[model samples]
Target: MFTPEVPFLRSSATPIPGRYVLVFDSAEQTESTSIGLRARAEEVPQILESEGYSLTEYFPRLGIAVVSSAAEQLDEFQARCASRRMPTRVVPEMVYHALSAVPTPQPTDSFEDTDQATWGLQAVGAVNSEYTGAGIKVAVLDTGFDLAHPDFTGRTVVSKSFVEGEDAQDGHGHGTHCIGTACGPRTLADGRGYGVASGSDIYAGKVLGSDGSGSDATILAGIDWALENECQVISMSLGADVQQVHPPYVTAGRRALELGSLIIAAAGNNAQRSQGNPGFVGAPANSPYVMAVGALDNTLSIADFSARTLPGRGGQVDTSGPGVAIYSSWPGAEKYNTISGTSMATPHVAGIAALLAEATGFRARELWAELVQEAKRLELFSVDVGSGLTQAPPPAEA
Candidate 1:
């Protein structure tokens, strides 16, 4: 009984030591009857336990498990499953990083923050949208958030940490910035607006630690929690540089959409188009079920670092967002900061997704369709910008 390791397109991604992700096919898909499905589900845990693997976490809803074991022990378990024709997939756990890149020099553009809103709000038409994401739950799974940020003073924000030994507080500023872009207050103390879904509930899940890195286990847990909470929109501004679609996210994203939650993720920032290098969309984002977002500058141009779509299924960019020189919230006394990357772009799409959800009562795939249909088609190539810049639905659409 020997099962081959899950194959991925070659890239710099390295698997975590002694950690693996196990995915079980849904009972409905693998078994012909409910009773059979139940029996197989029950037996999965017992089989893992007997195989000398430590079951670190089990997400029954997603049929995903994170396990720790010696390499040989995992091979034996995989072989047993293969011999029994168990429809299970075993992949080495890999680390993902926050998608934010170092801010490059600002482009020559007249769009800047005004008393009404930041450049991003203006670029995406969030300023004129009639709908605020009221009552909609938007989850941002990232490095955490600044609970004490003044702009979030009165907002309803529920937070939890999936990263071990860390609270939901954002030690790194990336998560705070993303949350602000997605669900910050309508008007800050200075009377400037940054967030899009100003009225949406915020669910901040700290999947990445302070060092700005997280393994697949923590990320999957965050997605599971977001799904459990029934969030309509889940924003993930993180990914690895692997060009191939990861199997775990394939299941996670598909199941999320089926459950009425749309997972929006960064398309990755590994490109350097100025140097003639157009990077490909990476894992999680490259999964077909997940909506991949590329980055756009204020001039409505694709950012130099924005990844291009790769050839084949699940490797295309689905949309673009205001990413470069984007202004948003920060932690502690910093209060505010301006940065760039597909990370900044992702929340713009998430916040807009919230608006569409509130406006059209659309969830999951429909919400995704509306967002793409409403995008302001840019002059860039489709491989880079997808349906072009994401736009907020106007009053008429609402």
Candidate 2:
């Protein structure tokens, strides 16, 4: 089998229901990659080696950092890791971190999905494809959020923070952007926001804390929480460096599918284009059951930062979306902002999955198959955009 190996750091421990979080450089925020690569990722093996830890997983690309939910938790593990002197980050378990309210702007039409929006319109259609995800539960696992965003006013079902005992409201601003893309109020062009599943109830899990960083334990806990809630579809805007799955996290994803949940993860925002690297997809995003996604620009051109597959890979990216400077709701329902990343793109698929599940009345594998089979190939018509994106009517059922 493909047992991904990690250093002494435990891959995944107990399935603690919590938030899906990220641990990025607080100094490095999620912004459009107009220039250099914004969210840089790489394997953490160097750090582990320095820490005197042993690794044996088949996929070390899926490196994991040891973390504890308790205060001062994992101190020894961290110390061990610290001894390595490698740059490392820990994402708190995914959960919601509510931010102070941001004043809502009178709805604008800029964020609307246009016919020219290619992948963007398809996403709208995907959400409307089944139903508005009204009854079906959808989870957004990403960076911090803004609870005060007008789009999410009071619709957030459950907001929990696992960033080492942090609040569930968004602080990093990433969670809010992803949420807006997936299920925010339809208010973009003509008042339609970037949301795909307009009516679906969103549960914000701020796995990436205010600093946009988190540990593996936090991610596992967030997954566990989604399972406990029986979330129909989960959208993760975060990605890991390793190609293999995190020990327990991999198990958790499989378990989620077995329990009838579908996942949509980001293909990553690495500038493989500039690196002269061909095939480079992110982990967790690259996991077996995940619906890996890529990003595009306003003109429907693949985003320069979109992760690509090596030369021979048929479909490195399952689909693409309007990730370049995509505008969406921020936490605190306060204001509208622009951000980019496959992170922004993943939610678009999640919202679509929710709609598909509700409309088709299929869970997990069934829903996943439907989405994949139906995805328009991004490579099909560069003119039409990749995987042409998805368009589903509000699901027939929820």
Candidate 3:
């Protein structure tokens, strides 16, 4: 077996001791290694222990399968090489039905801009009958939303706020805007543009306070809530400055993925040319499993204020979206608001995922891989731009 001088993990949720992750010298090696999810946290040690391995880190909400950094295990797995992707597949309880494979969009004409119906081309061409977020439940982990918003006409089924002293009301307006971009009713008229996925159900996970800022504990709690709620798509339109990832954020993101939830976060807007350089990709967004997004201009150009990448070759960000003057629904009366940042760009993908999840029925890693594979790779401003824009690929021949 060829050992690459590093530990290995079957999945991101499996906790390993120390601030380390299982690393493969090459993508091919990662393909050679085995990856699986844990069916039950209780049986983790026994399953690995049957192989003389022990668990280091544990994310119960995600239901991860196996986690180890022991060099010998990695070597053994490498010897049993196979496809570019892992062969082993560990599974948790199939709590919810798998998203349907065929495209099944639930179209509506009179609802608010849940499908992002006002942005003209951006919303018009973004969805279709096969691409609406039909059965997927999205957890909007932000400030509380007005469940009575016309855009949210008949969309909300679950809502909980952890912003101590705050009720189910959106004072900051950030969460409402984020939810609208991801999924809302048919309010916009030009070309009938609205949210990218109109059929998706939004769970108002009020973590951020009325001021649009939240604590680490609140964010973590919201993650747990999403997992328990069986939400498939999670969109975080808020972010903090701080180039590196924090342990708490990493744990929460990994946990969300374990629960079969696709995680998306704003890459943050700090540009780094000022004193209060709040441009660094903050917590949760810094997590690997979470798709950290940057921003772009109308012509698919990188946003000037978008956060830049680190000084590493592979550290290039995951993707980018239209962040400049991009418009979407807000918390107030039937209306829309133009916003910027990876925050604005995040819902584009989140909405797209709802559409794709409605089409392909891919789980967390699967959805992420498809998103990247179907993305437009414009690595020009690798730092601030990340992986250019994200949009659906042209329809392939039947």
Candidate 4:
């Protein structure tokens, strides 16, 4: 309860004004050691209301809350907590943006969409896999999806919008592109296959809004919902460029793992290796309990904009995927588009996770281990690419 000042490194992530995230210590942390901690957790909302703070959202399962209050009230609450063992921490709510990098011109020799499959499908060996992730549930949390897009016709797409007053529809196009990569059709009308886990159930959570930005509250809500539905794999193609490990995601991820769900997130697009800038991985990908994904070009080299690993725990890239000039679905009459980023790389890994789940019957931490063990090790530094580029289980392995 005595809220300590949360130290943060130099970060490019934006903070939402006057909003703070409250993280309660888990039962195991406080129940045996401290008295009345259980009651404190249950009475947090009423206690905050009495202290002049408005509780915006309370996630009981995650032991977290979002609140709006004056600076003086927060200060007073901290003072009161300092006198008593409060077992809660407060940090400023941060805004996370979709991690799509600026589109670079596709190289003339780069792998292209063919009559059979996309270059990403080839890179991950998904095109050759026998498993189609038929019974697996994959959740993609982003800026909604283009539900009306023809590519999703006759597919089981369960969608919901966490962004208030908005429907689960792709307004920014990033989510649709991601969904296309992770769970689109096995074959398009033109006979080209772009998706990896084409037969998996689609759970699209509109965490980010049409503008491609969402606060921690919205994103956490999406995670909670996905966990509630018992999604086997959750894909998040978004992140904030903060160097510190966000505490809330640590709790959410650990609990998700305990529940047999794995959360995969973009490592962040803050680096420009071409300019000698090797950026660090950011939250929530940087959380040890979550998986952080990097981006690779068609030649199997690291992308210039993909973030590198930081010096501490939860800061390393867990794996990588095809992310440059990749072709996938889009909104409206355009129907499809090609883009790049760790954002795009994320779904490639997620789709592969689905295939692996379908192939090996693994979930949570075991699924994470399977992905790293099966990856095609690259010549790149482990700091930049971790275990290596993610690969699908071949027909023999499947």
Candidate 5:
């Protein structure tokens, strides 16, 4: 009876069938309304099954369900929900990819200074911070991680793979690099550090596959898992190159913040601003509730491929980080490599968020605001770098 109008777009048509997430009012509403809503949700699986749609999973707390169906079925489903005033929404299942690795570098010990390998760590003052993110929990959702990577030998990591039959192992290398930057060891075997919040608990959720691609459903499931684990920080280095916000992600982000978890995403790597063509921020990250991060080079310049914020676009780049030719752990026996993208920039912020979480006990929006406040203000427009490059939190006063 208390159906609020949900803002979600309808799909026309596509060859392959995809998953759609239907959202209803929270199950924590008034008792009568909550009961009614739960009843309606319980009826959903049967209703969809009757209509030839398969229900994938349901989150009773958030009042959301994922179903695999065709566009035509989705249109009919939307109409039915509207008729009943269910206040439901259909989330698009678009393909999103890892934003970096334009040119893969071979693993080498050429860089004598380990700190020199990861310029991002130094850029964010990771060297000075005494806090190693100990006791803090961080979730990095991307390609599977390398379970046998030597650098992570003694670390405590919990991993799960959401990609149908795949295991949570980094065959693509992107997730391993991201984990290395966000929660890798304080000091590598060679004595040079390349991570922030090095001692934080690592949660690796493999949403993307070895091909470095995944759909919205896979990614959303990963978000659900991260929030369920009560991770203080969720780092997403993958996203669809779309200008508009995906409705389910917006809902998921709001729910995560409400539950004291912060989701950070890559702005995207599809821009050519200097060439008179600028790309807009990508989805999930483009959603207002999620923090959208861009890429900055060693010279403090925006990366040519980093997406930009534009007028009328719902999402804007929130902050920046060192993404150009940054070094970190790689998959296989190689051990390490350097790559670039807004994807690379994202983990820098996540690692820093972990440190801030450890220092201030701030959760959700407060944690987000704290990161923005301490960022090093650069002589650049807010659209390029919302509050400039992110900085590590300073030492607490006695």
Candidate 6:
């Protein structure tokens, strides 16, 4: 019931007119609220049957409800929610992008260059690892994937779309490219080898839309679905810059780790300290429980655009991976494209996580500790690369 005078995020997605989110302290409270709401449906004239607002969905597990109202009805709706002891906010639709596409690359003479087998695969030593992540379930939560991509033929892939009105198809190329790196085939039909966990089962969750963006609710829903399916590793190559970590993402990450799923996210591409302005790690990735990944170039140096961890703050970049001039799957006539950002770097860790999972039975925190311990130490500060670059486990036979 305590309404803080915090302003809506300036860059948060625009409010969908009249839509809001009501959060409760616990699932029991949410369920009780829902039941009480129904019992007093007639008394609450402002909501149930009035011109004020209407409930759309109630997710008791997450302790939230989606409601729609008119501009004039918002104040009354919030007051009523507060009176009912539920903290309410006009759900500011959060916009997330495929991190690889962030900071908007400048137009170069070779903008159309396309290649295969990114240096990231080599940088992480995935090229030499004998483990193919066989039997492990890896989830890539991003824009929907191209179901018809020839490179993924015969792979055991399960897909679901969280984007409203969109099917599980990669109209935007970001998801396809990330999936290509994390779970694509090892040897290409064209005789090129790219992906790391070529033999792992793929659970493609389309949290973003064809435009390469999605709201927080949609993303939360996707995360819930992925965890419910018990995927071992969830790769999120999408996020937005937010100094403080969002509460919902923190809760969700904790729940995921408890469920034995590791969520890895991109550190953001807003840094340009050489220009005297550097950005901090973005939310979801910034969550203490989520593993935040930064980008490195082929030479193992931090990418110019990769965000560094904020001093004594929540949004700290955890690990580094190859991100610059990276080539992976794309959509349509162009089967591949070279892109950059912490987004591209994240999947390398995800794929390697799958490999490590397959190599050992470590789950959640234990797996995370092993990954950091096995990373190659670098001369950079811990904030730039927590444990240096992630390296795959040696074959069990070794």
lDDT, candidate 2, 211-252, per-residue tens: 666655555556767777888888877654444443344444
Question: What lDDT score belongs to each candidate, Candidate 1 first?
Answer: 0.85, 0.56, 0.57, 0.85, 0.78, 0.73
User: On residues 75-183, what C-alpha lDDT tens digit does candidate 5 reach at each position?
Assistant: 8888987787676777655777777734223235322235433667878888788788888899999997888988788888999999998999877888999999898
Task: Write down the TM-score for model 5.
Answer: 0.86
Clashing pairs in 4: 1-86, 1-87
Candidate 2 deviation (Cα RMSD): 13.5
Quickly count the clashes in candidate 4: 2
Per-prediction RMSD in angstroms?
5.5, 13.5, 12.7, 5.6, 7.4, 7.4
Give the C-alpha miss distance for residue 33 in model 3, angstroms.
15
Alpha carbon lDDT of residue 129, candidate 3?
42
Please list the residue runs of candidate 4 whose C-alpha ends up more than 4 Å from where it truly belongs after superposition. Answer: 1-11, 26-43, 50-52, 75-86, 103-110, 396-398
Cα lDDT of model 3 by residue, 1-398, tens digit? 10111111001122223222222122222211212322223443454557665454343453333344455564564344323332232211110000001111223442123343443225224644445678988887777676667656656558898767888677766677777777865345543455667778888788777766655445556777888888888887765555445444444566566568887887665563334342455545777668888766655656556666665322346877666555566666656665555667777778777777877889788988877777676747556655556765344358
Model 3's TM-score against the true structure: 0.67
lDDT of 6 by residue, 1-398 (tens): 00112111112323455566544332223334544543443333344445535766554434445566665576666677678765444444456666653333333532222244556777787877899999989999998788888888898999999888999999888888888888887666564566889899999899888877876777777877887788989999887766766656665676677679898998877677557656678877888779999887766777777888986545787888777777788888888877777878898899999999988888888888888888989998888877899998875563
Cα deviation at 110, candidate 5, in Å, is 19
Clashes of each: 0, 89, 24, 2, 5, 1
Error of 2 at 100 (Å): 22
lDDT of 4 by residue, 75-131 (tens): 777667656666667789998878777544446776666887888999899888888
lDDT digits (tens) for residues 1-398 of candidate 1: 00012111122466899888987653235224422433465577777887667999888667788898886777777778767766677889999888766555566665777887898999888988888899899999999999999888778999999998999999988899999999986566666789999999999999989987888999999999999999999999988899878888988887788789999999988888877988999988999889999998877888888899999989999999999878899999989888788989999999999999998899998898999999998777999999998989888732
Instruction: Give the C-alpha lDDT of model 4.
Output: 0.85
| Model 6 stretches with alpha carbons more than 4 Å out | 1-17, 22-53, 56-61, 69-91, 101-116
Candidate number of the best lDDT: 1
